[model samples]
Target: ALLDIPCYKILMGCDGKNLQETKDLYNLTDAEQELLESKRRGHALFIIGSKRLHVNFEIPAYKFSYMGKAGGR
Candidate 1:
């Protein structure tokens, strides 16, 4: 199900317990796996291809935006 969407940055969960799942999803290296285990709370990897960036964000792009005033029904 998660394989369909085109994602720019994928948030990799910080845990070695789920090592295989994480590896399959992100294709993490040995160094990356070590780093993943060292992550503290409120930190995660922003996976962009082979590059593992720090900042993580989710897609489907839902956020507050200013629209015109609503007309009374």
Candidate 2:
């Protein structure tokens, strides 16, 4: 499955409060929205190829905060 594959690029430090805004801004599908909504902190995985693909995965909220503090280092 696409979700089972490891992603090449991982997007960190998403603000849960902006889930709706992010969904609206990105035109996320219902599945994506549900995935994002499931956790207070999550990261998005990107598998860019001939077809661009993305999926969200849960992470510790503190990790998200740390990523932000570290400027995504």
Candidate 3:
């Protein structure tokens, strides 16, 4: 989807060769890949063309109320 999709995307744990596997996506410098790795669990990468933008996600300060009845037919 990386090659075909034209909208903004958020990726996590998709550094190094994973970016290369996208084919059209260019190589990230060692420093860039390491930055992605360092932020692993807390951040995501937004790949727009050959540019990889780092974005820190903020979860809303509210919780989901119980939806209840999981798997109810």
Candidate 4:
């Protein structure tokens, strides 16, 4: 499903546990790194190439403080 997008890269960060892997996968943009800041509990996230789209796996409102902090960047 995700492959249909016309992007040069794809990043999947499955919770905080895969931080390094995610960073290695997408080259962690500055804003992206910052988004991972308060995600101590981590989450399943999908970053399509070139900011085309971002999908954070069903996190709760309170836990998504970083999202609000960044104001959807």
Candidate 5:
């Protein structure tokens, strides 16, 4: 059997040797670029889910944050 799943359920992966490459590849916004460039070695993971979106960071200590917008039909 096949289960129907929304595109948001799928996770996309990205990697780079440095923040600049990753920023360029993803075309990050000014704020995002500034955040990534804050540390000497920075990495970030972005995940989108049906109800929310998460941003995981890897720098000095492991950290993560999430945001969701309210909408309805």
Candidate 6:
């Protein structure tokens, strides 16, 4: 099943590769990196923030395991 959120939010993360460049440019807080690393290997991390809460969604490893799997991706 797919997870549904109620409202809109801003998501942030390191764009992988050139970690140093991303850090220098974005200046992400410790909390952000901490949150990203919380996910297991082979997981897609979504860092969502809004008026009420901040959250991370670690997508399942297999695309078929979730609903609306991306563009046969």
Question: Which parts of model 2 have CA positions greater than 4 angstroms off?
Answer: 1-17, 40-73
Instruction: Put down candidate 4 lDDT per residue, 1-73, tens digits, no spaces.
Output: 4444555543443346576666665677666665565453434235444553444555678877766776677
Clashing pairs in 1: none
Q: Which ten residues in a row have the lowest lDDT in candidate 4?
A: 40-49
Using Cα atoms with residue i matched to residue i, what is each candidate's TM-score against the true structure?
0.48, 0.39, 0.49, 0.35, 0.33, 0.31
Q: Candidate 1: where are CA atoms >4 Å away?
A: 10-13, 56-73
1-73 per-residue lDDT for model 1 (tens digits): 4642545655545665576677676677787676567764445666655566765344333432233246432
Best by TM-score: 3
lDDT scores for all predictions? 0.58, 0.54, 0.60, 0.54, 0.43, 0.45
Task: Give a tens-digit lDDT track for model 3, residues 1-73.
Answer: 5455776656666645665564335455666566666656558767776577878777553522343456433
Each candidate's clash count: 0, 0, 0, 1, 0, 0
Per-residue error (Å), model 3, residue 30:
1.4
lDDT for model 2, please: 0.54
TM-score ranking of the models: 3, 1, 2, 4, 5, 6
Q: How close is candidate 2 to the true structure, as a TM-score?
A: 0.39
CA-only RMSD, every prediction: 9.1, 8.8, 5.3, 10.1, 13.8, 8.6
**Candidate 4's TM-score:** 0.35
* Model 4, C-alpha of 61: deviation from truth (Å): 9.1
Tens digits of lDDT, candidate 6, 12-73: 44345544453443355666555444543433334344232344455666854675557555
Instruction: List where candidate 5 sits over 4 angstroms from the true fold.
Output: 1-17, 40-73
